[model samples]
Structure formats: structure tokens, C-alpha cells
Target: MSVRQAQGPAGRGTRPGLWREGLAALRSGDLRLIWLAQVVSQLGDGVFTLGIVVLTVELTASGLALSGTLMAQLLPYALLGAPAGALADRWNRRLTMVASDIARGLVVALLPLLHLTGWLHAWMIPVVAFLLTTGGLFFDPAKNALVPTVTPAGALVRVNALLAGTRQVLFIAAPALGGVLAAAFGTMTLFWIDAASFFLSAAILARMRVSGRVPALTPGPPSPRPSATPLPQGGRGAGGEGSPVRGHLLRDVQEGLRYVWRVPVLRLMVIVGTFINFILSPLPVILPLLFLTVLGLGTAAFGTALSFIFAGFLLGVAFVGVSGSRIHLGYLTTAAMAVAGLAVLALGAGPPLTVIHLIGLAGGAAVGIMEVAETTVLQRESTDAVRGRVFALYESVSQGGRAVSVALAGALSDRVGLRAMVYAVGALTLACAVLLALSPPVRRLARG
Candidate 1:
């Protein structure tokens, strides 16, 4: 049977529909292995983030230094995202992922080793973080591009939802566990654990039996002026000295960009997703202020409110995994945006803590739904040849938009009141939803 035909709606016996279907991807041995690797790596990531903060403070005690270190970890995604994706497309994805994990493991191991040698410095932390995150950038696109290969087309939503929801659960749980672990064993040990996690993840990935094959590109003549204008080059398998099957890396990046722009659904998704990211990025800053300044709540209340948001996200993921195939993605995404806008608008009212939690839950669910829809569509629409690059472009732009949004929102919030800023964001989201609803191409995505 075909892969799609092999997958049926999984929950036939006694398991809860949501749990059964959401975890259905685990039934596939290859996908289960990938998920297991993610669980290990992501948990380690949580601990690693905490360790970074603690280590940086111990080394520098400078808040600015801490911020810089954190930024270093994030900067690579925006800077190298596209090229990383292109590399994933060009190379064997499984090997690319394994290499990335091993590289990250080695880079992380350097931290504890450096400290043991009394050679570690505050500056070195950020440098190592930058390299570690660069490795993740390559790993992410490769893993994303690899998932569809291991999963049935009909099961893609369940797989994506499962992955996203697991990350969310880890996002909530890992830091608390990290804190306890750090207290029992020094922060240096956290690095060791994280390094070990990466290695374990690499081992898990290396065991997968998926094809190592990649798209074969046609070769062309080498550029005459190879000195001044260098082209991205692939290894020549059977052709002449200048003839590699794949184009130059630069040219491949260009093709990925052009492919995204030319594809109407992808174009709409990118533009809309980037804008939504911009709208949401400041929530980390804004939500805290909402609780403290506006609602006169404490840290405990803020944390609880955040929990509601996460819970909502989990619910949203479950909903999509179960029902997503039956719905039109374009419509679902647009409607989710509308709900998100209303939730944002409600937040501006500075309601009681309970009400705020409800709004947060709704808003979070909206975002969750939107994310799964967008990811599923991207995977469905893009061909395997360019899929990694497509995801990389989307991620890079989203990261850029998020960075810009955080900066701009902070500045704008000071000039205008926080509530006013919140109101404006809500209005813009609703407007964007309207734009999406009106786009014929977006509406026709699942239809076609």
C-alpha cells in the first residue's frame, strides 16, 4: 500500500481520540525515533538555556553581557537560516542532522572543558552559544524536511502537532527541572548533561533507516571569473572539472527565494506569518507588564497566566491534529487570526486575572492552530527538492520579524501607552486576517 493509504485514523479502540491521533505518528518506527531524539535534545536545550544564564552571570555579572549572550544564540537563525536550508537540500538530510547534533554536542562540551582548564571567559560563552545555535539552524531545517519522508501524507498534521506540542510541554517543564538539577549539581554539570543529550540524540538519528538520497542538480559551466564572483559549487560526480551536479550555494539560495516568491500560497503564508510573528513577539515583554503594571498582579499570577496560555496551546495542537484534515487550512488560519485579534483586544481591557488567563488561553490556541496550519501547508506545497530551503526562508524571516518587533514594540510602548500598543496590534492582526480572507489564492490552497 501507499504511505497515505497505510495510515488510517488511528484511535479505534479505547484511547482518547486526541491522544491517540496526536501520538499516532509514534506508530512509525522511524518517526518515533525522531520524536525520541527531539524529546532528548529539547529537554537538554531547556537546561542549556538556564545554564547559559547562570554561567554568564557568574562569569560577568553584567546584564548587558547576559543579553548579548542570549542574542548570540538567536542571531544565527536569522543570519544563516537560508544557507543552512540550502545545505540541507544539497546534502543527505539524515547525515546533515547527525552532523549538526554531533557538532552541537562537541561545542557544548567545550564549555565545561574550558572552565575546567580555567580558560573560559564571559566572551567565550556567547561565541560558543553562537556556534551551538548555528548547528541547530542546520538541524531544524533538515529535520523539518525529513519528517514528511518518514510520515504518511495523511499523518503529517498529527506528526507536526505532536512535535510542536511536545516542545511546548518541554518549554514549560524543562526549566524547572533544570533549576533543580543545577542546584543539586553545579551549573557546569548542566552543560555536561546537555552535551550528552545531544550525543544521545545524534545516536538515535544515526539509527534511522531513511534514505540518504538528495535531489540531483544539473551542472553548468563554471563562471569565467571565479576569482571575483564565486558561484556555489557542488562536487563533480561524473562531469568535467567545473561540472558539479548542483549549482553554487549562492545560486541555490537565490532559487529558494525565487521559488517562495513565485508560489502564491507560500508567498501569502510567509507575508502573513511574518506579520503575525511581529505582532506576537513582544508578548514576552508585554504580558509581564500587563500583569504587573496594568492588573496589579505579582509574579505568581503572571506565571499562572503563562501556564494558561501553554495549556491553551496544547489544546489547540490536539484540535488541529484530530480535525485539521477536514478543514480548509487557509480558512482555518484566517479564522484563528481573527480570534487572536479579539483576544488581544480583550487583553487591552486589563481584565481580572482569571479573565486575562482565559484571553491568554484563547490567544495561545489561535497561535497554535495557525502554526500547525502554516507548517502543514508549507510541507504539502513545497517539493522535496526545495523544501528545506523553503522552511529556512520562512524561519529566517520570522526570526528577523520577531527581533524587529520586540525592539520596535518596546520603543513604541513607551511613547504610546501599553494598552494603546496592545490595541494597535490587535487591530493590525484583524486587518491581516481580513487581507488573508480576501486573497483568492490563500482560499484556494487546500482546494487545489
Candidate 2:
């Protein structure tokens, strides 16, 4: 059932020729199917998001209507993500993922069918989006948790990097494809296409064999300081023989939070991740104002800038694949945040369009590198018992921060003026970076 390949330390097998390892994982066997399932599902996601926006707008003729659907997409992760993670840890990961995919596909299938039959309502757009994304809240953490178990330990960095890279690539491609399909054949057609993709993803995952349902962590001491300083792994839990988790869901949620609170590094990561999501999140709203009004650029120019930022992200990650293990993990993450702040500061300087694009690229690259570095560290340091919960908490809070930031920025931009708002964001980010740099505990943490 496992991929028939030599498993070695990620350093020896994945470090030297990381891309090769990722390709090897993808070019053959069970890993290939796992990777394909993710790719198929994500492409579907991109298309669905774009098509839905168009469809909702056509039905309601309001940008606010589109925003409602977007909020629906986000609400599940914000509200149910913790519970979803607890379930992932307690259940068979393979089945959790497969079931989620099937359910989401079915929900999405109803959109186009209902529309065709004149049963679709404008209100249903958000309702369906909420249901589909709720499936994602479960599916994402389960799939990520499965990777370290299935792949060589050393290759973890490469595999994680590839998974992230796949999603980002589609962020660019799938939307374009969706726009084309929706424009040519109508948004309902795009929904049908997305529904089909989800079914395909479920089918691929159903056959991919990965170890599932490790014994869950028995509840640690319910105190500010748990009995275990560094949470123990390698007992019956975490791929070993142990009692199944029958713990209260609330207790499981609290365990995940306490674990993060106790780890100095994890706390630092939370601080940094929250700021990163919050500060950078407003760029989409801010960019149009900057380019169209401030810079006197066409909409085409705004799109080009976005392309530049995403390209930089890809390139930064490409560098990470090569230098991942060799770099000091904590230091690289801290330094990347600091550098990103500098780039954002430059962005606020009202430079030429070319220079602005360059700044955006550098900022994005730094942020991208930080993303992989911290994820690898978390994967390495946390035990399998709490990994899903850890990732889910990370996803939830980061997303919640982004949502808050967009609203905050929209409120402030007109009051302070676009340029000043950009300056304020840059200043805050730079200050946060300085704060992290000054923390002795953060500085002393183990280097890469």
C-alpha cells in the first residue's frame, strides 16, 4: 500500500536534489495519486471561486453580494476549524479527506443543477460556499498530517514546498481558466467543471494508501504549565499502539492551544503569522487605489504587478527547496519578516511603477520564504498527535486576522489617504519585526 521507494533522512534523500525527490514522488506510485488529488481539488477550487463571484454578481449586481459569498467561504474555518481539527486527529485521515471531498463535490454539484432548473436563489450562493469550504476546514489539515507519515522524513521540506507550490501555481492559472470558461460558456458551466474536479479528486484519494488513525494524545494536565514541558510523542499515540481518543472535543481544542502557548517558538510564530496575514492582507484593496488613482496606471498594469508578486513568491520558494535544511530555521524566519517589512516600506515610497513592482516582488519573496521555514519547523517539532490541530489553529487565526485587516484597511485608507495608509502598515510591520529581533528567547532558539 505504501509507495515502493527507499525512505531515508530528508537531508540525504531530499536535500541534495530536492526537486528530483518531489518529482520522483509525483512521477510514480501512491504519492503521485495524493499529489494529483490535491492538484485536481485546488484547480476546482480556483475555478469555483471565480465562477461563483461572476454568477453572484450577475444575479445581484452588487460587489457587496460577492463579498457575502466570500465571507461565507471564510466563516467555517473561523468558526468550526478547531472542532474539525479535533475530528481529523480522532478519525481515519484517509476517510476524512475522501469523505470531505465527496461531500463538497456533491454540494457544489447542486449549484449548477439548481441554476439550470431555476431553483437557485441569490441567497444560496453564500449558503453553498459555506458548506463547501466547511469541507476544506477538515480536508486540508488531514491531508497535511498524512504527508510526513507517508514520505521520507528528510524529504519533508521538499514535499511540503511542492505542495505549497502546487497551490500557488494554480492561484494564477485556475482563475484565468475559470474566467475563460465562465465568460465563454457562462458561470454555471464553470460550477459544473468544478464539481467534476472534486469527484475526480475524491476518486484519486480513495485509492492512495496512507497510514490512518494514530492513537490520540491522552489529555495533558489542564494548567498553565502542563506536566510535559515538551509534549511527549512515540507512546501509543503518534503511529504507535495506544487508546483511541475519546476525549471531550473542548478538551482536545484546549490542548492544542496550551501546546502552542507553552512553546516559546510557537508563540513567536503565532505573533509573526498573525501580523503577516493582517498586514499583507489589505494589498488587494490597496493595490487598485494605488495603481489606478495614485500611480495613474491601467487595470492591465495592476494585474502585471500582481503577477510580479506571485512570481517572486515562487522564486523565493524555489530557493528554499535548495537551501531549506542548510539555513537556520528560526533565524531565517525572523530575518525574512524583517526583510519583508523593509520591502513594504519601499512600496510606500511612491516610486515608479517598475520600482513598485520590484518592491512587491521582494516583499512577497520574503513572506514566501518565511511561510515554508516556519511550516517545516512546526512539522519537525510537533508530534503527530497534535499536528492537525496545530495546523488548523494556525489556519483559523491567520485567516481571521486577514479578514479583520481588510475591513480595517478599507475603513482607514480614505481617511488617512492611500499613501499614508501604506506607510502606516509598513511602519507597524517593521516595528513588529524589531520587537521579535529583540526577544532574547526567540534569538536563542535552535538555528536551522
Q: Which stretches of candidate 1 lie over 4 Å from their true place?
A: 1-24, 217-244
What lDDT score goes with residue 141 in model 2? Answer: 83
List the candidate 2 regions with Cα displacement exceeding 4 Å: 1-28, 218-243
**C-alpha RMSD (angstroms) for model 2:** 4.4
Task: Give the TM-score (vs. native) of candidate 2.
Answer: 0.90
Q: lDDT tens string, model 1, 8-29?
A: 5543322355455555558888
Local accuracy of candidate 2 as per-residue lDDT tens digits, 1-448: 1111233444453454555666565554566788899899899999987888888988999988988888888878789988888778778888888899999999999988898799999999999999998899989888777777776534566676777778889988999999888878888888888888989998998897665665455445312221123443322233343345366788778877877777776667776787778888887888789778987888998888888889888877776766765566667777778878787778777788889789878877887787788787666555666677778888888888887877778788988888887777778777877887777646655431
lDDT of each: 0.82, 0.76
All candidates' TM-scores? 0.90, 0.90
Cα deviation in Å at residue 301, candidate 2? Answer: 2.0
Model 2 scores a C-alpha lDDT of: 0.76
Task: Pull out the clashing pairs in model 1.
Answer: 232-248, 232-249
